[model samples]
Target: MPKPNPANLFHDLPDKLAAELVNILVETPSIRIERIVSTGQCSDAGFWYDQEESEWVIVLKGRAQLCFADGTPPKTLCPGDHVTIPAHQKHRIDWTSASEPTVWLAVFFSA
Candidate 1:
């Protein structure tokens, strides 16, 4: 016997501002599969993720702004933009827009 593999899926948002989660992998104990997110009017605020893990993220479409807690100016990102949030690094989504949908692929894992 063997496990079945599902086909690729696509998700569309209803409003001009929305987030569609394409997929999520959960194997546990090691690196997870991946998370595909589509967003509009998203923002990174004054909090943080991955307190016990690290995150690798990339922009697949549209644009966004990444705000850091170190007083650094927000960084603009578009298609093909990538960033890694280190463990315990506080950050947020500075801004996003509805004109264009922002797509992101994120990988999270602990070390």
Candidate 2:
């Protein structure tokens, strides 16, 4: 398997993105880390991510919004912002910055 992730998270991004890009940075039996780049991407209508693993995510650049199934207002995240979603908690991406790519670091692990 290829061993290297990019040396920099902000490098090699295309000027226009047709969809969000996700790259696995690390993976083990119980944990996975990902680098996600979103350019004006949102979850498909009525789609929610309901994963069995807990997720802790941080916004490394740009901005985005997360919507939960509990009907609370979407939470906006900018650089330096972070949140943890417990296992099985339904959520979806509501918005992302269109003018720039939003970089996110996500760690998922079995709880």
Candidate 3:
């Protein structure tokens, strides 16, 4: 097998983004890790993400907002803020920074 390599999370970002760029950095049978870069992006209106795996995500740069189906106030996440969403929880991206790219590291795993 080849030796492991190193990658910079912030390197080689897109210049003009029509949509969020998602890169799967690692994957296993029960787990997946992704690096997502969003620029002024949000979920489609009336849309919600219902995933079978639990997710833990952290913003690495810029900012983002998330809204849940339970009617709680939207949550704003900054560079270091993180959240854990259980499987089947309905959530949506309410907003992302328009001035800069919002880098997110998301880990999805089986409960």
Candidate 4:
């Protein structure tokens, strides 16, 4: 088979978002990789994300704030910042930079 073409994570950002963009870059039975682009979007108040799989996420560009429902302090992420969230941990994106599109690389896997 021919070699697969590679992609740049920082290029070709989506325009005119009705919501945050979530693009699955790779997937398997046990793992999934995603590229997420956010333009000043935040989760709704009193809402939280509870995922079955563990997640490791990194900020590739711009900035964002993440908060957990368990009273943990919110985290501010800039370029190159990363965090690991365990399964069933309630969390949400509190804020994303309005000045530019925030790019995130997230990996989800079964533990």
Candidate 2 weakest lDDT stretch, 10 residues = 2-11
Q: For candidate 4, give the lDDT of residue 74.
A: 98
Task: Give lDDT tens digits, candidate 3, residues 3-32.
Answer: 444498988766558999999999999999
Candidate 2 structure, TM-score to reference: 0.91
Note the Cα lDDT for every prediction shown. 0.65, 0.92, 0.93, 0.93
Clashing pairs in 4: none
Off by over 4 Å in 3: 1-6
Please write out the lDDT profile of model 1 over residues 15-101, one tens digit for every residue. Answer: 353444546655577676564554565543445443577878888776788777767677788878888778777677766646756
**For model 1, how many clashes?**
6
lDDT of 2: 0.92
Clashing pairs in 1: 43-93, 44-92, 44-93, 44-94, 45-92, 45-93
lDDT of 4 by residue, 1-111 (tens): 965444878777865477999999999999999999999999999899999999999999989999999999999999999999999999999999988999999999997
In order of appearance, the predictions have TM-scores of 0.69, 0.91, 0.92, 0.91
Q: What is the lDDT of residue 23 in candidate 4?
A: 90
